[model samples]
Target chain A: MRVAFGEAILRLGEEAEDMVVLTADVAKPTQVAAFGERYPHRFLNVGISEQDMVDIAAGLALSEKIPVAVAFAPFMMRAWEQVRSTISRCNLNVKLVGTHSGLSASDEGSSHQSLEDVALARVLPNMTVIVPGDREEVKEATEAAVKSPGPVYMRIGRDEDVKFLDEPFRIGRAVVLRDGSDVAVISNGAITAEALAAAEGARVDAMVIHVPTVKPLDAQAVVSAARKTGAVVCVEEHSTIGGLGSAVSELLSSEYPVRVRRMGVNDTFGESGTYRELLEKHGLSAPHIRRRMEEAAEKRDR
Target chain B: MSSAVELADLRHATDVQKLKERIREIRRSILEMTSIRGLHLGSSLSCLEIIATLYFLKMRHSPHRPRWKDRDRFILSKGHAAPALYAVLAEAGYFPKEELRTLKSIGSRLQGHPDLRTPGVDAPSGSLGQGLSIGIGMALAARMRGSRSRVYVLAGDGECDEGQVWEAMMTAAHLRLGNLVLIIDRNGWQLDDRTEEVKRKVPLRGKLESFGWVTYSINGHDIEKIIEVLDSAEKSELPVAIIAHTKKGNGVSFLEGTNKGHKLKLSEEEYLAALKELEAKPVCE
Candidate 1:
């Protein structure tokens, strides 16, 4: 996934003279190394200064440059004020890329894991938030981001080998992986795979909604998907407050009030562990999602 | 070409007297804007001369062409001074001066602070101390793009308290952004208190110098002197910081020299008095 991001940026740099990359001293880890090396003049490494990185990106946008600032998900929120005031309010064309999202940064401890980025980022006006599930999705999503106007918050994970099934990707559109009438498991990012796995194990007919765009969300599609399934279960490797589950809940409550069982980290940070261990500990694995889905489906039937 | 001839030509081309008239028009628009939608009237007052100098004398922009790519970039780092920039930008014909009446109104492009959504504004700023870093980015972009167009940022002394400003300074120096110019509005007053008591920047020049920026200090209210220094920074091959010493409430006598004048809603009587005080020709130009 990281390599895909680098390749997409490299292509963007060739076409868009104004396309520049900035790292909060996290380029190498974020897989922006190739873009940095190829375009040294355009790459800026403001060592460990996330706040400065955001402000500088806004400035570059002011000078008619397309600035892409890269960092970990947690650090992106650390400079949240700069993002709100400088980028969003200014309507500067800045692309904020956060790597190592959710439990994807397994073993890096809870502090490095960002489970609440989507919830907070979406609340800000004029910010488009995206979380691609795998390598192919990352490439497609980033390319779409470069063409889109205004501010964007894109989240990618640390895992590189996750299978990215060949599918058309567009900003703010949900990809329905299956058709089902009993239940729908809506998910994003790394948890999309888990949602697929959960659907396979479900006793009743189930479907998966792979929504990459969390903000300026496809409300109509999500509501339609919910109405079809009758019961919905939102799965993610993020917090329940403001991640995929929360957004789905907000939409459902206002538009299509449906029963939703949210399967994610419930208000607790993950401890240091392997990816699989963390998933099990936080009840974010396929089994947990399946269990939650079955329970919600039974309740809906009642 | 002789240096004296070039200086004389620059002055003649700038047309200082015509610029003064434009400043009056800007002031009138600002007053009208405040009457329609009250904003940072006091902070706006503090930066009038600097705004006038940049738009009229320093910057290479055509009022007819606000989106000209090669024109010098200007960011109001002290976003609270939006009223001043809006006034000047309108008078300079970036937009119709009538749009000034929509200052801070709902659905109006004129936000409380400088925002790019508004025409002619490069970046949005309300959070203090981040504009400088944005300016550095613009400066660096111009350098990498091999454009001679410069980036100028006007920062408030009070905003220097933010640590991010220093971080931006370090980045700018490290990059040797010769096309960037920083003009600090040393108005001495901030929101609730004097800058010295709040965050003493007594050795501001020394601090910037140590950070590898070539420095200049001038009376901000003096349009001619400011024009000279600004021209120098534009021509220089190193990032320069011009500390413009200024009064908080420059044109209005009663509010001048006091921190209390930073943000206030003048009474009907006080508003008239302020206008009367400003009716007289400025002491320096």
Candidate 2:
């Protein structure tokens, strides 16, 4: 999923004349260094300065340039204030792509892992938030982000490349991978692959909906799915406090008033472990997703 | 947001007398605008002459056509100095002088800090230590487009305490952005107290030179010196940082170099005296 963003930058750099790529010293890890190598003049490496990268992107945007800033998701949050004031406040067209979102940082421990970027980016007034589920979506979302008229924040995973999506990607649109009336399992980001597995692999008879755009969410699709199933299971690799879970709950409770079970990290920092172990510990693996889906389905019968 | 593109037409100050008169008018406007809220008085007062010289003489911008493609860009990194910037911008016809009274009020285009909502503001700024980085971005973008336009950023001396300032300094030097210039308003005072008292930036020029910039130390209030340095920067191969030495509250006697100038805590008598003092010819040594 990380390299997919770099591949997209290479493809788009040729067509988009005004596109400028920037990274805060993690160019190789985020895989944006390929663009740097291909077009040295268009790429900027603000060594270990995310705040500088963001404000500089704002400056570039003001001068009729589209700057895509890539970085580790956790460290990029260091410049959240800069994103708020310099980019989002003024509504500049700067694309921000974050790698290792959620616990994908894995053994890099709690500090490197990011579980709150979705909430932070979602709350900003002018930012469009996207969390791609697979390698293909990361590339598609990166292209869509640059096409967006204003600011965009895309959260991508470190290594989850579960490529199940075969449909055309569109902003603010959800793709239904499974169809059922038992319950609705809705998710964004890499966890959507797990949600799909819970519905398809386990024969759970639950509707699986992949929502790539968290902001300007596919509200109509989500509400329709909730109304059809009468129950919802929200899954993501972020904190359940204010991520896809909060977004789903906030939308469903007001619009359709369905029973929603949010499955994600319950507001605790992650611990060091293998990626699968951490997912199990945080209740984000496909088994946890299946358990939550079954519980929501059983409770609907009551 | 106007789509109209026009050639740059600027009215340069013909002499020192004209420039000083412009500076005096800017001070008067700032004094009147901050009467109610007393917002950022010392910060505004310190950078008037530098801003005045730029708008009247140095910058090539079209007032009526603010988004003109070929125009030079100015960013106020020391955004608390909005009163000074607004005064100069209005004097240059970016917006009406009548709009100055709406500062800090509800529904005013003018905010406490410089906002892009206001005409002629290149980038929105209030938080310190962010402007130089923005200037570098603009400078690089212009070069990529093969345009000769330049970007100027006016920052405060006390604001150097922010680590991002140094981070931006490194990038600007690394890029060798010849189209960018940074003017540090060295008024020797900040909001908390004296800059050295809060944090010592005494060897500011030496520090900047070490950071790989072509540094220049100048009397910030001197119009001719400001013009000379600004003109000379165009030929350089690297970014330029100008440390402009100035007094906190330059025009009025009681307010100059005093904490009272930081924000307007003046009594009616002192306020009238300030206006009367500004009515005289500007003191340029």
Candidate 3:
């Protein structure tokens, strides 16, 4: 995902000379080093200071420069205040790329996992939150974020090759990977691959919708899917409480009012383990999503 | 090259007495605007001279063209000082001085903090420790464009307690942003108590120097000294930090050096007393 982001931003830098990339000493991990190596003049390494990086990005944006600040997702939490006060509040044109989101950094423990990032990013007014599913979507989302006129927070996973599809990508729009009417499996991030597999394995005839833009969500598409499927199951790699699951449920409960089941980490801290083990332990694995989809489909029949 | 020469000419052409008079008028306007109930009174008062020096003599900003691309930028990091900044902007003809009364009111551009919506405000900042980084960003952008514009950031002593400020200081030095100038309003007092009492053993100058900034210590209330140091700092080849020692609530004898003046609505007696004191003092001693 970071590789895709790096390539996309490098291309963007060539077109937009005012595009500056900032990092807090995590350039290699965030894959921003590629952009930095190519455009050293436009790259800013602000050491291990996330808060300063965010505020600096806001400043650059105010100066009419498109600045993309990259860091580990959990580390971005340190600069949450600056994000809220400076970037979002002022509605600056700054792109915040948070990598290694969710349990992708499982071995780094719960402290490194950014399960609450979606909630934090979406809560800010004038903030657009996006979680691209794969390498292709990551590149698309990075381009969309740069084009956005206001603040954007793009959450990218550390896991490589999470299954890419040659689907049309647009910000604030969801893509239907497969069409079914029994149940709607709404998911985002790298976990969308698991969602697709869950629908197939369960044979639940589910409508699989992959949402890359979590905030400013394609509400019309989600509503149409819910109305067609009659039941909804949300999947994500983040916390079930405020990530994709909660976003879909919130939209359905208020607008369409459907029976919804959320599949993700129950409100609990993550432990150090392999990415696959962490996914299964947190009920975000393919099998867990399959069972959740089956339950939603059964409930729909009853 | 012409702008630098114009700035130098303006610095000499400026009348010290007239600048002091403008400061007095601005101070009076701030009091009148905040007579009912005000926020950040002391914080605003301490940095009056610093801001006055910038808007009147130093900064290369055009009130008529507030969004001029090559103009110098000023970020009020210590946001509670919005009234002081507003006063300067209005005096500089960014807007009518009458708009000062609408400060902190609903549907008014003069928000309690510095907002970019207001004319002449380059960036919205009320959050502490964040403005320095924003200044760094602006400075970096200016350097990238090869513009002669400089970025000035005014922060409070207590605001320096935030870890982000140190991070920005390190970044500015590392980036070698010579066009950035940070003026610290070392007014001694904060909201709850004296800054020294709250954050002891952390000398502002020593900390900045250690972070590789060119540090300058000056009396903030002295308009001439503020101008002189700013001129020198602008010529330096490194990021500059001006530690301006000032009274918490300068110009008002009763409110001076008192934390109680941090935020308050002046009583009838206190208001009258403050006005009388300000009126009695000479424009420049």
Candidate 4:
């Protein structure tokens, strides 16, 4: 997934002369090294300092440059204050790419996993938070973030070669994959692949909505889906408290109240495990989402 | 041509006496604003001359064209001193001097911290120890665009305690950002205690030098000395760090050299006394 982002940036860099890529010494893992290797002058390694990288990105933005600062998802927390004060508060044109999101870091343990980044990034004013589910969406989302003005936080996972969507990708727009009226299975990020499988395996006619942009959330699409199905199930590889599940529940409870079941990490830190094992242990696998979807549909009938 | 005459007038306009008067006026404004809102009195007063010198004598910026591409950038990383920055910007005609009275008031552009919304403020800053990194970005951008613009970042010595500041220092040197000039207002005092008392002591000049910066130690209160050091820094081939030894609450007698003056609500009597002391002082010799 990060490789897709790197390729997209490299393509964008060829056209946008003012675009620069900055990393805090995680270029290899985030796959931004591809852009760096091609445009050596445009790429900068700030040497393991996320806060400095963030502030420097703001400075570049002020100078009329589109700067993309890439780092691990958990590391962005070190520079959250800079993101809030310098970039978001001033509405600078800087893109923050946090790769290896959720439990995608696998063996790196709880300290490396980023379960709270969405909540942190969403709270900032004028910030666009995006979590791309597949490889192609990662590329498209990177392009959209570069073209979009103001600050953008692109949360991606280390999961590679995930299934790409056939539907067109747009910022702040949700894609309805498998449309059905029985239950709405809304999910985002790397776990959307699991969500698709869950809907198919559950044997329930489910409307699967993939929300790429978390902030300025496609509320209209979510509301329409909730209205159509009357039962909603949200799955994400993030904390259940403030990820897509919370976002979906918040919108539905206010606009169109419905029976909603959120499937995600139940506010617990993830331990060291393989990505698949962690997903299964955290109840974010296909079977768990399927169970949640059935329960939500049954609750709606009751 | 008339452009030559305009340039001549600008040169003639900023004599030592004129600079002194400007500093005094800005100091007065800082006191007035702090008297009402009661914030950052000591640190703001400490860097009054440094801010005044940059605006009036050193930096190549026009209030008429605050966003001019070729203009120098100023970032106040130690944003607690925003009153001083606001005063200097107003003095340079970025906005009306009358706006200084509304400092920190609701709906005022003169926020408690410097923000880009305020004319002439290059970046939003109040959170300490982030400005150098931003300045480096601006400097790098200027280099990338083939522009000759410089970036000046003024940070507090106490703010240096933040690990990010050192990270920025190392990165700036590693990049050899000769267009970047970092001015540390070494006021020696912080809100809770003196900087040395709180942190392990290291010779600051040596630390910066070891970090690969072309370092200078200067008397921050002296406008002439600051101008001299800035002139040299402008010609350097590496990033410059000016450790400006400054006194907190510099101009006034009662509050000078005290951490308690960090932020305080001044009574009418104390405010009047401060104004008198500031007005009676001779320009730095």
Please give the DockQ score of every candidate, comma-separated.
Answer: 0.76, 0.73, 0.84, 0.86
The C-alpha lDDT values of all candidates are: 0.83, 0.88, 0.88, 0.89
Tens digit of per-residue lDDT, candidate 1, span B170-245: 8888888888888899988888688998879989999999999999999998787888898788667678999999
Mind giving the per-residue lDDT tens digits that candidate 3 earns over B24-111? Answer: 9999988887696676788789999999989988889999999999999999999988999999999999999999989888999988
Put down candidate 4 lDDT per residue, B1-285, tens digits, no spaces.
Answer: 999999976775557679998787888888888678788888988998888888888789999999999999899999988988998999899999999988888999888898888999998898888999999999999998899999999999999899999999999999999999999999998778989998853599999999999999989998778988998998998999999999998877888899878988788888999998887777554
Error of 3 at B113 (Å): 1.2
Better of 1 and 2 by lDDT: 2
- Per-residue error for A206 in candidate 3, Å, reads 0.8
Model 4, range A1-302, lDDT digits (tens) per residue?
88888789889999988899999999988888888999998899999999999999999999999999999999998899999988999999999999989999989999999999998998899999999988888888998899989999999988646874987679899999888888999999878888888888576788899998999899999999988889998888889898888888888889999878888889899999999899989998988888888778777833
- The per-prediction CA RMSD against the true structure, in angstroms, equals 2.5, 4.6, 2.7, 2.8
Which ranges of candidate 3 are over 4 A from the true structure? Answer: B1-14
- Prediction 2 TM-score vs. true: 0.96
User: Best candidate, lDDT-wise?
Assistant: 4
What is the overall TM-score of model 1 with all chains considered together?
Answer: 0.94
2 or 3: which has the higher TM-score? 3
The residue pairs that clash in candidate 4, if any, are: none
lDDT of candidate model 3 versus the reference:
0.88
Estimate, for each residue in A59-117, the C-alpha lDDT of model 1 and write its tens digit.
Answer: 78877788899999888989999998878875678999998888778888988899888
